[model samples]
Target: MGRYRETYERWKASPEAFWAEAAREIDWSKPWDRVLTLEGDLSRWFEGATCNTCWNALDRHVEGGRGEQLALIHDSAMTGKVKRFTYRELRDKVATFAGVLQRHGIGKGDRVILYMPMVPQAVVAMLACARLGAIHSVVFGGFAAKELATRIDDARPKLIVSASCGLEPGRAIAYKPLLDQAIELSEHKPEACIIVQRAELEAPLVPGRDFDWKDEMEKARAAGAAPACVPVAATDPLYVLYTSGTTGKPKGVVRDNGGHMVALKWSMKNVYGVDPGDVFWAASDVGWVVGHSYIVYGPLLHGCTTILFEGKPVGTPDAGTYWRVIADHGVKALFTAPTAFRAIKKEDPAAELVKKYDLSKFELLFLAGERGDPDTIQWAERALGVPVIDHWWQTESGWPMVANPMGLERLPVKYGSPTVAMPGYEIQVVDEAAKPVPANTTGAIVVKLPLPPGCLPTLWHNDEGFRNSYLADYPGYYKTADAGYLDEDGYLYVMSRTDDIINVAGHRLSTGGMEEVLAGHPDVAECAVIGVADALKGQVPVGFLVVNKGVNRPAEEIAKEAVALVRDKIGPVAAFKTALVVQRLPKTRSGKILRGTMRKIADGEAWSMPATIDDPVILEEIGEALSDAGYGRKG
Candidate 1:
């Protein structure tokens, strides 16, 4: 703890010097004229610098005589395939693809969208764009054509790279057909499309706009075409990643070149505690931010081996898939979402399969992408016998804002909190008027002016949207839109979204807090809480729960126990009265609970269905359950 305080003091004293020193670790083409500059709400680091992100990720290591080092390890349980690529091989492939893109008239500042699966080609596409200074936007592979059409119309890419099909546990999803339909539906179409034929899935090819990906690469290699790295300005755009908006249309978060490179490289050693040649695995898809930072750029920049696993946590083979991967690859650091653990715990509560593997090499496990409830955290810690660190960040911030720094000093684990803010982030809890509140008070989370290096600079083509969404409410702070409080020791306890707070009889209550207590019940597998309209109180807490399978317990009995557990843990002020057993809770594909949607459905209000919903049928089930409970008026 003292070590944490010491590091914080050094950073708070002189942040510009602190970050400038961190930037020295990267390989720069030319030095910057200024270390840091701020204008109103925007920040620029390493102004006037020229650097190529692809060169730092690939060429630098190969030039340093570490070309033989392993750079990528891809293993897919669905296809039973294993592939490895060294730094030298990766650089050559990137150069070849860069040449191919150039031949199609895609040059610097041109937009190219990549809609491929979790294969090695996705990484190559991203690096190829970075090599030529082009901007690449990758959409998740499983999205429908209507969803893909909106992105195509927004980005207006000159070219698109996609695969023929994607393989899941029990089926093969056709991607080329999806792309075709999306192109037909979109108003703005790309000039050409490149397709990787994986399983002979036939797709209609337009007369002069579609080509085979492998054939183009072969032709480029045969002609001895190799594209050199193009130097980009420090403030140039690196990539635009759209958020998985559960309630609205997605926003493109734009990340810059030099700052993103420097911040990710520094965080690899300082936050994750891994170095060159270490094995790091983040169990997420390439479409997400974690995959962008950890799986692709961060590990490669550090010359480490990153595992890209194409399998689900529970179904790929069995409940032991994650354990098997860790043992097989000797993974040193593992990162995933807490919802995964909840699923595994539901299937195997006693952890019988986990005991079968040898996990001596596993060092740490990280949980992100949602709030980590205390019950889930304790279960993971006890089951794996390792520290489960819950870090917090957003898509806007490329990397972690608050984490327990394993490299600096490991702090004592707090069951329900993401530890202190990382260096270079000034976090504060404030009321509605933008005034600071005392410790142990719940309020909106805000970050002071001059956000650190890796944070988003602005929205793509929508600078006004960026200002109104993040900076308008707080004069000099970036509003996180999350409701949380800071403890006496400076630990952060993220309660829920601000709208998720329930105003019960003029007292505020966090549904996250109530859900955590309900999850402690012996027979409860999963639970979701929402604030429903009540005549007596302004709002009241209602819980929807899923009991463990094969538990041989009555639904009514389990609900009574859950209510009793909440009453015993949290006092009467919580206003937690009712618990209804349900089949499942509605969630997005990324595994976030749809509490707002649930609340609307329970209150009999019309709501727009979110685009990212995992299963729409679950919404009907929830509505029926609510109707059976006598809250059935539909408006």
Candidate 2:
């Protein structure tokens, strides 16, 4: 048997022993009395242990003689700036910043919200918070004031760290006004604010309430006030990441320090197949879970050089920017959302710009955040001549639940599937009644509880809410909210979110399955399949196709081909007769298609604007397209 199977079986047989061994990789100030403990439906790993996440990420590495090694590389295509920090340099900066926070009365268990751009200061601030054993919440930079206000009220942070401005391709977005507005709107006001003044646009700061980031750091340095790491309990909350909830309120998913460090550190070597000192880059913002796990903590905890990229996949200069970064940095692995590659594919269909850079050092490419259509994965595989692996996880999981374990063994690539469950996750496909479904039968995907190390233990300050949102769905499992089937070989196929399963004349169909067929079209660069209201069939699928940049065929012709493809692949039961060719699909800043909002628009229901929308104008374009196709509210 291969190592992956053996390791999985060992974990299955003795989960406690398996995790106890993994826990040893992390440096603990106090040893755990028990490796695993369960209370009601909640599971806590490494209970009774004490550790500091920042120490494991930075100080330990510095002390271990990797001090001069490159720890972080911040490359900003928006500002045309590049900055590097070694392990020692990063640790010193984080310690000094920790001192600054300490002076502001921030201590263990205190909450600090970081709303900054993809700059090194943002990373330093996060590590500094961890160094002081404080819980940090990072909201996406430039978030709407109302949304930011909601987060502020929920987290009740003592202080906020923000930047003056955030850079885009052609312009700079002033973040200070938004932060000020959020503070004005929130019921619970923070005591102080620290603003980073970027050269692109310096924001006006309020005296006595706001402090300059540079000034505080300089003061801390002048006083030689570098604080040592503060150890906290293993179950102490490390960070609270807020994900959109069904109740229209955000759910703050809480991650603990010890389990987070162990699982992520192990994943860097065993899952990503990257050794210490290798350059790793996750092209995502720190506000998201991927950024929290991989960009800041995971790579650093594993002693690897992590890259912080502040640019789009295609727009910063051209489609060649990703390749250029990878070739220049000798990045061994690149993890990003599939939407990024689709954007690049739309602009450069033939990937001719790939020839301009040397990507021989780029070993693997990982895609997540949504279902990676087989067509896109295959295209990336052929274009890059590397393994384009699709992994599946969520903001709550904090790490990959289903993935191809490249380090243990290179499993055969399976299109439309993330491959198999990881060591800690026991994935199962079950029906609404919580009974296991037959293999290859579509059902809800869930993980058998207690969830492995690194997964969210509870919602911040809302234990009942956590139980209702996750545990109540399936009594003995953690509801993934995703729909898919397990193959005969045990490979997990994450078809789509459970809500995307549309019922057409009593037959449930996965929109993702139809989307896969549509994405396979030669001219289709990107696509989204949403189920719209249908009086006759209850619900029907609608395909929105964005063709390649050079495609000159009539939109109607391409639409007809897409309809035919879905009909051929999924049959008439799909009720997918209508397809529209649109310029682009509306997506969030993190590249998630706003399907729920789109559905509301198509059905002509009362729907408010999404706060995280990348471009609100795209929704207007979509409504017009729907109206043109004799759907939605008609004049």
lDDT of 2 by residue, 270-344 (tens): 899999999999999999999999999999999999999999999889998999999988999999999999999
Task: Write one digit per residue (lDDT tens) for candidate 1, span 597-630.
Answer: 8898888888877767778999889888888887
TM-score, structure 2 vs. true: 0.99
Q: After aligning candidate 1 to the native by TM-score, how far in Å is the CA of 415 from where it should be?
A: 0.9
Question: Which structure among the candidates has the greatest lDDT?
Answer: 2
**Candidate 2 stretches greater than 4 Å from native:** 245-248
